[model samples]
Target: MASLLPYGDVDFSLRAMAGRAEGFGRNAIGGLHGPLYFVTTLADDGPGSLRAGCRRKEPLWIVFEVSGTIHLSSYLSVSSYKTIDGRGQSIKLTGKGLRLKECEHIIVCNLQFEGGRGHDVDGIQIKPNSRHIWIDRCSLRDYDDGLIDITRQSTDITVSRCYFAQHDKTMLIGADPSHIGDRCIRVTIHHCFFDGTRQRQPRLRFGKVHLYNNYTRNWGIYAVCASVESQIYSQCNIYEAGIKKKTFEFYTEKAADKAEQKSGTIISEGDMFLNGAQPCLQTQHTEGCNMFHPSEYYPIWTMEPPSHSFKDVLQICAGWQSVCRPAEISTNLD
Candidate 1:
């Protein structure tokens, strides 16, 4: 087995940790007090496989020993108190993606999820009451249903520094219009690159989401969607529509089997629009929807007036990277 630049008792950097994301999942200490588990096989399941580590009842910091594609037969269900740290190797999951449900204290960092087939599939599905999760520096693309979906009352999640590309229905939050319990869902997304995705970057519903420092460009349908009583705070982001020229979309949905429909609220602060991306170009829906502001959660947050300078920064920083602990780079720096 290979080592990944000692990150335990040794002096190292935690910058790559998903918990480092500055959002609702900032408190997610994923397997920090657990033992290390090395994944030495590319098999879908069994010993030395990713499924084995993810299914463990106890906490574990799962690392990959070899770099290859893992063709999953079904959705890889992840349990609580686990950290799937892919820093030393390049691993990709195909055929199916991850299923995070009813778990907590999990961190998924620096991996690639692609080509997930089957209906209702997603690159990383955080569904059904899961909380305290952080997904960082991941590259998700070409999923059948969505690249990432956080629905069904999940909260305290942060998806930062990830890349999305070449997919329709890129992301969905709060899938169920009838599930009114989704109002408790809270997520923070920052430093992500939504590149040429079709729609749902993401189509949100009933969740209070904080999106900052993201680069959303070349959207097919629309860049961002606010639907069904969601409160979205889009700060310091960049939106560049390719041919659509539409940035925001407002969708109405009836909740809890009610006949009356209501849309969500959006507070766009310091966002840059390019390539004829119209900020007011939304569906024929009524405005003045009420929402909780990001200042209600944290009085202060990082926000800069959006600019084209963000394009280069997001393209370089967002997505999976070959990140080793600082112990490996300290010597070279000196």
Candidate 2:
């Protein structure tokens, strides 16, 4: 039931989308060969807002020609080669959200983050030492804390075709367990659509995540959460359960003086559970944890083998869409 998207037609090419940023952000290349900035109001800051073209510092690519909702009153600090490109206008960013500290090449696409209020608000907050990031097709929801919060030593990131709802904790990779430099986090979530959010659909401690073909459904308090020495590689995802069907949860932190580390080593390949879904995995690995394999980070990171047709292709191709794209595409980056 989601149609009607004719924002005056579009034609975006955007430098041929630079190889479509994949796992480990595939070298972001954000404001890809720079210069474009155009967000004509819905003010939250001066001069054509969007926080004055994401507090420009150099490369730009921000786009938007007005479509509605942009309430934020703070926390819009986005620096580093930017590219907030919200497809062909249909934007939405409610009160307080977005803050990628210590930035790097960034690329936040399509947009629509809902009501995010006071203290610790986050709809997108990559922190500490951000790196090449690529959050595409955004559409987060009611937030107070997390909708996306990559912590401390943030590393190469990539969240694709997004669309989460309601909200509870919903995403927090490596922050606690005394930071421990977050073991140089490296994320790569694919084709997202964690609808009924509740628990951190993303909850890692010392990161190295890489889930694929996501389409989680009806979660409440357990849908992928592993504390301490984190490392998840649940491939071909498609869990679907309502009354909490334990899709992995192991929180018992206490690292870096290491004594009480519970569990953190998820390696469920070709996943696909329905109705009473469950993968409650944790079959050992609490001894100096370290077990990752996304082909050991880049050897071919692109998959799709869990279908019921991605539950309607992740609710009609994830979020914030208005079809007909191309208000600007910045030509031929040489």
Candidate 3:
């Protein structure tokens, strides 16, 4: 029928975008007070290059106008108050990856990461104490460790409008349960596409997470997981399971030393599942333990009514919105 004719794409595709007002990672602005800098060369490291500019350790807007695969020889260590905007071109990062350690207020958007391999490489690694980050409209595949890894007390992050495919260990919020420092990790993952990933659409630990409005197709093993004191709140997402009947939405794994212990918590609301996907809620912890609740962190968001069904919203708005491309906005910091 006419209803099936890429209706979702017509409404939500990148071609429909006009500006950045509806961008999902809209709040993640790093250094709007500074001047805008563009990546002029494909050189990974040089006097005036991405690697050199990021090491300046000052507040600035970084944009890329050229398109090429930059094979990083070392993990690009980003400084504080930097925004790497790849919106206007097709930039690909391969061979190596980016690292954010103890940084603040960074924004990464509209790029592609593939064919990366090296010592503990990831598409983007949010290291300890990193905060106020926004990653959106990116594509990632075949990373050595994870597509994205937020660990070591990283907080106030939002990952949105990204396409993740052809990978294993898609995302990880917390590295180890016993690393009590990870208790401070809090992230929001919204409107992303988990396509053909094997596992860990995000295996969590020792953090508070909120997942909303995502579209998942062809999950290899499982969809969402919570492990070791992690509190995950999933809302209004769509999941299409793979061939295995065990392609579930929620799962719990035994922590390293606590094999018999109940792991984390999963609280979901209004999620859609198809193709024999059924996930049982599992939060069998001991009595009187202080577990985090979803409502306390984020307010419930409502979608506009009629004309668009839940399936349509997932297909159209989940990965990338071309019509409303991401733009830099200034804050009231003056």
lDDT of 2 by residue, 1-334 (tens): 3322211122347544543677888788778777787889998999988899998899888887788998988889999988888877788898889999998988888899999998889989999999998888899999899989999998999888789999989899988887789888999998788999988889998789998888888999888887777888889889898998888888778877677665577888898999988886745654445677777767775566777865776788777777545534434576
Give the per-residue lDDT digits (tens) of candidate 3, residues 1-334. 2322112331242222211212222345575556777788889888558888788877877777577888888889889878777666778888888898999878776778898897689989999888878776788899988999999888878787788989989998888755668878888777778888988888888788877677777777788877877777777677778784443343345455565545777776777777787766644542354756555665443332222365564455444334332454333334
Give, for candidate 3, the lowest lDDT window spanning 10 residues: 14-23
lDDT of 2 at 61: 80
TM-scores vs. true structure, each candidate:
0.90, 0.35, 0.82
Error of 3 at 159 (Å): 0.5
When 1 and 2 are scored with TM-score, the better candidate is 1
lDDT string, candidate 1, 1-334, tens digits: 2211112322254333534546788778787667778899999999999999999999887888899999999999999999888887899999999999999999998899998999998899998899999898899999888899999889998888899999989889898798899999899888889999999888888888998888998888889998988888888789988999878888888888668898887778788888899988443443665666766765554445566765777787788888663322323222
Clashes of each: 1, 5, 8
Q: Which stretches of candidate 1 lie over 4 Å from their true place?
A: 1-11, 14-18, 257-259, 281-289, 299-303, 325-334
At residue 305, candidate 3 shows an lDDT of: 20
Off by over 4 Å in 3: 1-27, 247-260, 283-291, 300-334
